[model samples]
Target chain A: MKQKTLALLTLGIIFGGIFLTMIVGAWTTENTKTPARYTTGSAEGEYNPEDIRGSYTLGEVSTLFDIPTEVLIKAFNLPLDTNPDTFKTKDLESLYSIVAEDIEVGNESVQVFVALYNDLPMVLTDTYLPTQAVELLLSLDRSWSQETIDYLNAHSVIVTISEDSESDKDSALATNESKEPDAESTETNNTTNNSTSTTTSTAQEATTAPKTEPKTEVTTETTTEHKEPLIKGTTTFQQLLDAGIEKAQI
Target chain B: MSKLFKNQPKTLQKKLSIRHYVQFFFFALIGLIAINHTLVETGAGIPFLSDASLHALCPFGGVVTLYNLATLGTFIQKIHMSSSILMILIFILAILVGPVFCSFVCPLGSFQEFLGKIGKTLFKKRYNHFIPQKVHDVLKYLRYVVLILVVYVTAKSGYLMFADIDPYNALFSFWSDEVSVKALIVLGITAILSLFVERPWCKYACPYGALLGLSNKVRIFKIKRVEATCVSCNKCTTVCPMNIDVANKTTVTDLQCISCMACTSEESCPVPETVTLTLEPLNIKKPVSANLNQ
Candidate 1:
């Protein structure tokens, strides 16, 4: 046969095989329906809002900690229904707390893991941790507070914290412990008038104040002593190291 | 004596290969059937085939689908087959590959090219000058606009307009006795145009080809001319179904070349190592000659 004829024949055979395969694939293959349910326990679990617990559905974890659910599901090989509702309240809350702590320490993977863990419900099994998540947690933002630092250290995790030079540690500690007296007195008076309002306000203030105070201290210290505006939102170095220590426990 | 006689070129034998024209006829036949099927409901007229259905007979479509899946993040679904990503990728690939789907793969393109050869033979003098370069270039862009419009309408309305209008589908359906009127219209227009000009639809109307032409400049595999060896023969240029001037340039002109390799074939351009397809850089020193020694 001529080379052209042979080449054409070869092409025809190859195309014929491919055509047959395609026909088989399309004909035998049921028109791909939107899976009534995604494959459970596949590399990645599907996202279903129904899996989340209570009113707290998994919003954008990526925004909070830059963790994609798709990555977590694939990495962990989590079950399909392993959503936020499936996890015990304690597990979910603990996961949330851990993520918060990881944020303080700047541990990326731990933060992602916690986010993913929190999103999963308590019931489903086959959980796995991603190496990327672990790597990310180990390299956290180092400027955490002393409380966070102490917590991390006790947990046996190490972290670097940015320090505040202007902060007279001794005075700041004294002020933190002492300044509460005036605020507590005012709070007490308000509590007597409207206990519910006072409690809610106090809780909100307590959560927010701690985060901001440490940031302010770091900024002040960086400007006065380090000659820089210590990267904002970073916990004091002591706090971050402590946060890492706390994570080591889990 | 018979061998010697056979070796001598007779007047009819000197004509371009009839195989391409035959292939072109088959393409037109298919197109006609497709259009007829679209117009009528008789299963015996022309088979009507959907992209999904034809996907069974043509593995190339499946390969194309897989390519769409990888690049476009498409999930295969039955009811809503939105391979927008695939469509986009096809467009992008067309820009880079010079509408290869049309030139080499598309049965429709093959048919059109075949008809174009016939048009060349019948209207030798009148059809000598094809569409003007600038007008051709502008018209080439129409496919993108059509693609965009078709895709937008399909996405928004959830209808497969292209599938209905595609001549290839119309032709494939002819065997099954199912034809699509829209598809038939498209095929009819394409066939009529082919009679007037060589591969007219490919040059001006094929949206897919338009995209390929845009990307032809960056294709990894391209044709290069060895100017020094060229006997300045314009035979390559004349024989080009797409009306490209293959003799002059180092690189195949972006708008004209389809990588069919017809011009480079031994029978077409008998230059010794003059025109070649290569992945390597072109040498600029050698100037292409216009006349062939033959």
Candidate 2:
């Protein structure tokens, strides 16, 4: 083809492909990091742990892996008040940046935790989890090969859980009253206050709260108000009241 | 300014070619898409226009995600189905004419060429000849290395590793939060270098360009030089952006050829239909000994 025809043809093909994709409802532009499913083994058709992204929230992880949000929070030693629905797994990178330079305790750790919790097969990496996560995994009555336990022992990072004094007191109280099934949850929190009090104080100074940006509040009020008749240009007070405005408020 | 032009002969004013118009269209479209993407993120953009991210629009993303898609059954993060579709379409075009995307479509190539105009005026005859031909021949192969490293790393890490340092991404997404400092640095260096060189990135560093350049060897339509009507003036070689010796070659199968058609008879050749892009192959000349024996 000549340069002119080539140029036109190139534009036509590209635009045509895009238009066709849009018409076929396959033109995805959003950042949707959907985890890939396993293709083989007992976990066939199940979500692969390796496909877990840093963008996933703890709540999403909980739903996907069938793990409790509380267990995740406690295992990771996240602040007691943290909203699991908003807390991204990437926050662990910043939260443990001091130690992460040596051993990364971030999204990969979450993947490992989820895999072990569900007893699903996984490709092992150099990813490390908190000591509490290791302990929680060991306590489970699952089919734990000695090699896996040894691997967990070697990979466990002993990060001092950093929280304020009031949360520590509440954690201690919860631990005292906790039942058998809820024992690990309280113990994970209680360990933060009981041991390494000096290190905990230092770690508290180093650690910052995980930043969860406020979700954009979509306002429907403008559209709703636009649909309503405007009380203007000789409109009556009775008309305003009929429009759903209280007389006293008006 | 008067002294500069006083003794100089008046040259013919160059008009915009079909290629120039195509370049401007893509450059403007990509710029608008990037801005629209950011505006849409803030919930205040034109609703009808596409607000796809640069990653979503880039065919290179599709190239990088191939291994991950095959092995893991998923694309790299931030890349989507559109990238793969665009890749397929671009490859089809490449197979037909060879990397017309680089000359007629790439916004980055156009951006560099835009800077190269200023370089042409400043350096005059010396423009696009900053590097020695011998050194350039060796340096041009670096882009292949870059392509290999990018593909390998992206596959291993399951991330777009090149994104952090990609000058093309930085050029369009400089104002956005997604642009990395390393990418900005690379973009800045590329901009400054564009004032001295013609498409320095495409010559020595563009992984995508390296991938597309391979199409030159297998393209259907080829740039062929006629041995009979060819003037020895070498205008085709002088006008070549990639510094290819087009006048000497019977068939231009140079890997660096973007199929820009700059060296074609329609563009730079003094004789009509002498140096042309055609599906027909040039006649191979018989050797002197073979002709004598015959």
Candidate 3:
């Protein structure tokens, strides 16, 4: 009822509430395993490349996933010499706004940007890239120079296919021979090299091996290895991956 | 023209009152912040200050999220955690200072004050001239109704219904696609009405103001009139934007008092120690001492 009493009471409520929230917040933050939302940096520790979100900057992502920062910047058409970690999806949103408004700026499709920069399964929709991203990508002018194509190849899709014909299986096995004897238990350096090369180079390297004397047969096999399953209607890049296509092959 | 005006002390003299500076400071601060947000969105950005935009800085968003959290057990996704913290800070300030945020910090309030200045010049003697006292007394209660509706719909729908109609959001987000047509219309009407009525939206429609106004009844520090020194001069009553009857009341218990301090100023009151804002000390039998002033 008295003014002093009321003032003290009000002060008590404020200090008390603030203390409670701080204590709770400190404890919750200590226990939290997930990265804080809306921030980007490597000092926060690494996360799964597959699980990477739009809020992360290119530099943070480059360090975590070990993707080449230059390749990614080029793929996204970012201004040269940008600190990858310094820019995030929020910045990209800024770029999008400029492209829409300012005549001085040029436009790029966000779908193309995401697809080429993030080699993992982000922006996917089961069989393909996300539908909205796909729609945007359709109108984009993707100037895939041969080198850019190689970078994309190295970061390409997973192999979930099991329905290959017996002969197709034979060729897939043949490509694994260049892998070192010890690490062949899972995949090896050979597959990475094969996966990173152009389609013709991979085929040429596969055929020229001394163990394979059947050159014409190997050429036909390589064509079937790539072209046959891919031409199927509705088969997306992801589906090609599901059918055992590598980045180099796709 | 009167002896009272001549007797007004020079201590509170100002080309611009504290409230005017506060209004000017906040209006400029918020405008610059809004521009920063837009520039960041457009990629001509500098990595400094805060990356969170104008909407994140609004405390009212936090208030709505708190209501949604209490009633629906889920926080609105669009409302940031920073907003919730800001809401708590505002509540703290209200309890201590009796809704000074309405008079000083809230950009919308400052905007209304700016328009009110233009109205004062254009209408001269007819400034704040549209509404009668009787009609205004009844209409001022409508903000409470709006408060309830905003909380209810936002909780029930699990979405921010208030953002669809909030004029502050409209002002900051006018160029963005997120700006609601209804909100823009409300903003237009509020700006126009500001010319005829002081703080039209704050008095009659702002749910956040309705919530903060409650602090006037129970806030710790308050503007109090010293009856021993008080004259029957009604100068304090004329200066109050919220129209509290400052001369008639010993303690400003009116819910509409925004703690702007115009009434307590020496220029407005014409006497020192007549009006003060402080916690009432325990049964004092003598005049205020030097230690008490500290």
Best by DockQ: 2
B38-131: candidate 1 lDDT, tens digit per residue? 3442223444533234423332233234432453333222222323323433444344434444554567778676565566555664563657
Show model 1 residue runs off by greater than 4 Å. A1-30, A33-250, B1-52, B55-100, B128-130, B174-178, B253-256, B281-294
Could you say which candidate leads in TM-score? 2
Which CAPRI category fits model 2?
A: acceptable
Which of candidates 1 and 3 reaches a greater lDDT? 3
Give the per-residue lDDT of model 3 (tens digit) for A67-116.
67665554443434455655653344334212111111111232234434
Mind listing the fnat for each candidate?
0.03, 0.65, 0.00
DockQ, in order, for the candidates?
0.02, 0.28, 0.03
Which one wins by DockQ: 1 or 2? Answer: 2
lDDT by residue for model 2 over B32-54, one digit each (tens)?
99999878645579777788889
Q: List candidate 3 stretches off by more than 4 Å.
A: A1-250, B1-14, B68-74, B281-294
Interface RMSD of each: 14.3, 4.5, 10.6
lDDT of 1 by residue, A73-108 (tens): 323222223352222211222222121122222222
The digit string of per-residue lDDT tens for model 2 on A1-250 reads: 5778778888898899888988998878654656888776656788877677776888889888889988897788765555777677866764553342345578889988887787666655456777778878877766555556545655566554334334433422223332344454355434321111111100001111122211111111111123234322134678666766676665
- The predicted structure with the larger lDDT, 2 or 3, is 2
TM-score of each: 0.43, 0.70, 0.53
Collision count for each candidate, in order: 66, 0, 3
